[model samples]
Target: MAQNGSAPVWWKDAVIYQIYPRSFADSNGDGIGDLPGIISHMPYLERLGVDALWISPCFQSPQGDAGYDISDYRKIDPLFGTVADYEALIKEAHDHGLRIIADMVPNHTSDQHVWFKEALASEPGSAARERYLFRDGKGKDGCEPPNNWQSVFGGIAWTQEPERKDGKPRQWYLHLFDSCQPDLNWDNPEVRTEFESVLRFWLDRGVDGFRIDVAHGLIKEKGLPPYTERATMVGEDDDKTPSNAPMWDRDGVHEIYRAWHKLLASYPGDRMLVAEAWVKPLSRLARYVRPDEMQQTFNFDYLLCRWNAAKYREIITDSLEAMHEVGAITAWVMSNHDTVRHASRLGLKDAGARPQGIDAAHEQPDEALGLRRARAVIFMTLGLPGSATLYQGEELGLPDHTKLDRKYRQDPAFFRTDGKEIGRDGCRIPLPWKADGPSLGFNETGELWLPQPEQYKNYAVAVEEKDPDSPLALYRSLLAHRKAFSLGLGALEWAPERKDVVEFCNGPVRVILNCGDKEVTLPEGEILVASHAIEKPGFLPANAAVWMTEKAE
Candidate 1:
């Protein structure tokens, strides 16, 4: 077992890696990544130099939303592993000095959950139904949905239950996401008490902490008013906006987190929570990380910024300022299970456009350009003064499986919109471990839930690990230098920025990124690491970045 004397603020300066378990590795040759598979890869993570691992939801689920629609909070999904396997994984990870942050989905539950099942079977006014957002329909025959709100996936947000055999009109349930995922009513005291116990269940199991899913969507306004605008995955409303949307970033959500913060603080091992709230305006987003609330929240504004130097600088400044006000460190992320991988995203003609998914029919990305920019941005992101999140396979410079066939697509968004939206499956394909294998070494069997592209062979860990110039090598070197300099703990000091370039100093380390088309002369310093090789002395290549320390005397 690992020591529990870790600093309570360790996460502030830690580099936490997000692992999509199903796509990481497969131990049972079941064609799915599981806890055992993750256990086997513990050494690989240690080598990657991340302080913690934020494993996406592995709780018992019906796979309705790739595990987001959880059925049982206390049980591990059979597809992933048994509870014993999870315990083994936690032990193995701790032995490797890596903290485990489990994903906690609080916004909704799978319709198949025991609570939801009981809600469906019981009368409308019963305690069971009150646990979720069940309400009377609006028409004479009770055929209309409770509200005009649309689902994030598509169509109506409300799903009507089957007609009662007793001839009483059935009540409709609220599901902000897919119909299979019914949103729980946070206003219900029973629901709040149930989730608090769930948190304690995992905390007692020796896990480090949790990554809250949809952290902002737990509370809804009174009356469940109709939303006139189109429903989005992340709402635009902020604290300053008048008549804020009823579903997202409501003031009441903070109260829930305050109670959660108190619970986590009581546990040993410095257990913490990272919110996945996509609230607009850096100020509103900062509210989640207030002293008494969540310790950190994902900086979506920084992630969604255009790949321009000015835009990057602006977002970085705004983010740092906002987070500083709350006395909390910002959590920066470029890509994840939901968004397009930065390697491919930055290569698109319009890098600012956030397409749901890419296919052969869509505008193709400039592979080389994208990889170059991705590398540069990562260097700059790491140079910033806060924790960073590296998505799985990002160290290998993995690009989105843009050409994945629609037939193999599994994201609910695709089917919900009748293929109009390409869905997030392209970015969630199983990772390539070997350069050449039937399933690219993702599994012993040649089976894969979502197929890997042939080009992924070039980005395989086996291939990259052998090449010193590969992204994997760069990442390892960067992480080492980052730790050596204590960059994460250092404060940022911005230098007078040049056109198309971002320059800043973190203590003794001076970081320069050339975002322009032409190479820029490097400042006088001892070179520590560069994203791209410096062909000429004192010259930083375009779309490249380098870290340097002050020359001795």
Candidate 2:
């Protein structure tokens, strides 16, 4: 893509498909999916057509937070296979003309990571001890954690040490995510050096690039303030409450990233950096993507929109407008592992019907057509001005599927226990890969780590792949269309999608959708992509989406 060689090894214009290793597909029937499993599916990706695959974290970890909590940066977890497996996977992907960008979580590491464990064993002044953030507190004297910071998963963000050394009381370290995920002390040059080496480790292994997680949480203020919030008002009080003070997107994080980018600059291809900046304000968000640090930061305004056409239109337009001036590349996302699936969020049908085949005929508002409609939206979004992120199973239009009752959800949000909200696990369930196989194409060991719909097996890639009209097929077509036009640019123009449709244009191409409840007339022109069955040049169903590039007329 960057010719023979270029530097940010730019994936900015790339359409990245996320692969949650544990749930993607099982090659060994070991219940858990592994690198080999992902390798096996690379051809499928090439066929479906994508420039690159952004596999989710596969590094060594306890997996309490799936692969997000890394126990070892240089090694792949045995559960997901070994370093050799990863090398093979990457090499094979490249062989197939696809790029592979691994997920890198630099802000924190699992408490079980060797560095953190060593830090716990050493005395305060020891080299190992200086590698992490630690501050003495009254927790050893039966007092609560220092400066109440809430964990993103719930409860206090800092965890108190059970074991103490010398006469000092027990100390605590901050974790913006789960307690097991201890935040790294970026103030320490050793921490920066260590993470820098981690990047080189993969770069040496020939990785295309990295999608840095919680990219802005590398630093924290020297002394965080105590938590305080009014309890009188209720409903997700956690949002207003400070189980602990916020520890993300803090001060001094830019220098840390700039330093990392500097280290990455020496590599062969232009290494790419995409930051996940969840903090508010487009101004603050802009810092992560300045040419010095990351190439792009996640576009925040576009995803939170409600399903209404006008609302969606504004978010899209505003995002493009705001970022248009910034020197950084743009990125767009409709769904990710952390949020509700787009189909469900858009109020489309999941696996709600009985096992019979889905009907293309008129149906309830939540049926499969919603997925088809979603695919069309994805095509337009990915084909727009910046880079795009694809959550695993989004290509299949997979909906949320989780069975852990209220009490067992691993999400800290549930532990925060805000009026029975179904944490994010629903969006992280195993994928269905076969038409009638047990455990879908996912895990086989005990019932999968999360629940699977009965229609799960039927939704597998192996099955739907045969049907030319399947959601997977539409995704492939979109990807192919993208590959043909992504590198070069065309101006984007807003077009009519209908009362229910969401429409737009990129140069000479036009995209139309019938995201509403009735069939619509297609604009007269050359058609590029239609989410639903197209009997003629103009007729389209209620949920159909169409893409086109008209001839001179």
Candidate 3:
């Protein structure tokens, strides 16, 4: 963003708000969020001070793994709305100065997708079957899966392809996620052509950008080697070092993006792509945003850091330095559809590594403590020298609904793990718009796809709108300051004389975060914002952050 010679791209300083469409807002009382619902909320987002909106997948899907298992790349899911409805949302969003970035899930398609269906109908060696990874099972009757790789959702990655019309033994097809979501073979030219067409279809409709889901997982190693190491939900295997895992972050992935970059360049309006790659070490993550690849990649390293000041500074420095090498801006994220809400996670004494889901309804978090830390972290995330994303409900300081009844959970991981993991249902609960309603104003009907926790009423937009110190208020204030101070566009340098604290300056603004247990003396300046009330005017308490401007010389 600080680079010269050409005008900076809008995304460099943009504050992107991620909306999980299933829970954002529902129109037509269908108990599901739709494009019309997002359109109605554009003014709300504009008021919130975000520059762009990245809507989670709304493509035609079978509702397995939510909308990630897209059935038709060109059509809007009937549950969300019609194509006309999506076009209207894009037009309205742009009119309000809010760019729309649609989610593109190119890693795989729903088993119900036309190609996959045809693959099932055809024999193992057919051209349709070649679009996906199909291999003969390695056993006497060829019943064993091709490999021992594990699925992200807690089962073996390979699923037996349905029997052919002749009723011979079936072959196995690779599915890195749920069985309903079959991995597409990037080696196939047809697969690449189809996705390029999908990109153009939305770009032609005025969409400004795309948030690529599983961007690093799109390509696999040619041999499909056995996966002997355990994998974290998102990143490289347990050791924090890159491994030769046949399914993730393969070198072949870069070629796919290089081609995609060319396609995006062909379109006007500076259309862009942000990769949701979870590869480790800032160096590997930086590969996603190389000059010929995506414009930005999500900084999961920062998101996964424990609540320690040293780690915070370390990751920030590492991330920025990595992006600097690639001449790309880093993107920061707090929470999203797939993870636990950071608000509640911050409350845990140990916090541990990010668990994909809570194990029990009884593992309640301390709401007050979590909200304080969450509030402080926002200043740190937004003040950094790059783009930032706000997950829906995070601005409301919404904690994960840990008490959701097991019967109501829909995330496939829950069922796959057989109750050992609760899945992402906690963070995916429908948002509370108004203070009171049968479904807390998420829909006109009393029903919702995922039930809202009763406690959400207190954190509803209406209530926060009236509270000066609410998370919503803090977010709006910080976003306003972020733009006014040119924080995201500025260079970052660590400030001196801060002990047990992460202190930095972004251009004219000095940001200080106290992650230690003791109070830290605040540097003298005009106070811009503080995460918590200053018990002593010149001192900041533990688990807080402050933004200040140096006084005139």
Candidate 4:
């Protein structure tokens, strides 16, 4: 943002460093990471050149589903810090030239929310019951849930909350996420107004923006399904089926966003209201970024692609083509707190077997130089559409160490009745701030939320920051280069000759990446950036890439 206050709240074209508070750092010597812990690392993030930081949910919660289960909208979770500590953080972030956009969970609150408790206490069929998504006799009978839907973590999405009648306790509350994370009855105007007040509370506190959680789940039908078991309706998977098209992509959601825009517009700055819709297809993903809705939304498409040249290029093309709205820019992410880190997702597992064509290090025919080659491709990735978001410790080249021990595991989804798949605890490990410090410099005392992969101690900032070829240094240079390009526009032009080459021309700049193990012949062009073997200008080796502009013919 400009010192003159002309800058917007969107943090447009700026990089956001996502911090998972429980793992970022610990300042109070409490084994768990906290707000003050994150504050201590501000300087590291500053030197890293990120414009803003997106901290995951730190709101008051039962801690059942981590911080996602909010027991109170405006209150702070003691596990993190007090509300004043958070306010001080926002102030500190501003002073350090960084903005803090917090995680806002509006879809639901913990079943412990006063309203839910009161609703549970109220008589059946009363106005209170209508305030939530509930069913009679578990709805449609036969133990069927409201519909055929699954939970994201696993298991049927619906759970019959303990019916509690005022003096007693009776009537179940429906939770779309965990049993405790009951969905708010957005159909009610009162629910809408309640959340609006929550919005104003944070906005009034001078928070820069909000990363809305499960934003799509906020609006669900008021009526129960024609026929379905509660378990089936609550199956644990994203609702791939659009919410009955008419009501699904209805004007209601758009109206919600537009209304927020107006309310937020009253406050100065370009405040952001990013949605976390687990939607699919670039087309569907584009809907959340409606000019009036949200300036930006996550494109899960890029995150799901294979770590290969051909697929990567296709993803780039799809992203650019999908988000061509007049003022709407593109967003790219290789890693996040929710998914496996790019290193492991890209198949760079140290103990794991090699990918088909590429060996353990992705040393395929085109990648003669191993990870260095991939980093070259990533340079172009970071420079492509919208603003790029980097997960914490990604720049240090942290691999997904999600392979957790049975006892240390806390993932609720992993314990679902069906069974367990490794959860995302790997990517959420504490930052390795020092070369060989305890918990990789995460905390002064107490155990880390997750174990630091043995090798991470060497991969810490203290070690990698000094080495030019280190991932950290490379990311630093790449980010600076990306920020230098104000347009942030590029056309992923395919190479005319070789199939292994991926070439993109953005304005006058061109980037070529060789995906094969063998050397690649250079197109007739002038070199601007080269990842490997720049010593000999024209020709590029396997896994090599070069930046270029049209040669002065």
- The top-ranked prediction according to lDDT is 1
Alpha-carbon local distance difference test for all models: 0.88, 0.69, 0.86, 0.67
Rank order (by lDDT, best first): 1, 3, 2, 4
Cα error, candidate 4, residue 347 (Å): 1.3
lDDT of 4: 0.67
Model 2: how far residue 406 lies from native, Å: 5.7
RMSD of model 1, in Å?
2.5
For model 3, residues 423-540, the per-residue Cα lDDT tens digits are 8989988899998989888988877998877789999999999999999999999999999888889999888736669899999999999887789998889888999999797999
* Candidate 4 structure, TM-score to reference: 0.86
Clashes of 1: 0
Task: Name the runs in model 1 displaced over 4 angstroms.
Answer: 1-8, 235-243
Q: Cα miss at 204, model 1 (Å)?
A: 0.5
Q: Would you estimate the TM-scores of all the predictions?
A: 0.97, 0.86, 0.97, 0.86
lDDT of 4 by residue, 1-553 (tens): 1244554434557688888898888887666789998887778788788888898999888888888888897988998998998998898888888888889988778877788777776777777766677664444432445455555565666776563434342334566567777777777888888888999999899888888887656665445444232321111232333434322343456667777877776777667777666565567767777666676776666655554667677777777777774346676776677765656544442211221111123332221233454466666666565677788887887765534454665666556633344555656777787866567677777477767767777778889978887888877776776666542543445555457777766666677777676776787877755666565556778766766778796
**Tens-digit lDDT track of model 2 for 206-279:** 88778888776666666665645321111221123222234556758888778767776777666777787665
Residue 343 in model 3: lDDT: 91
Q: List all candidate RMSDs to the true structure.
A: 2.5, 5.5, 1.9, 5.0
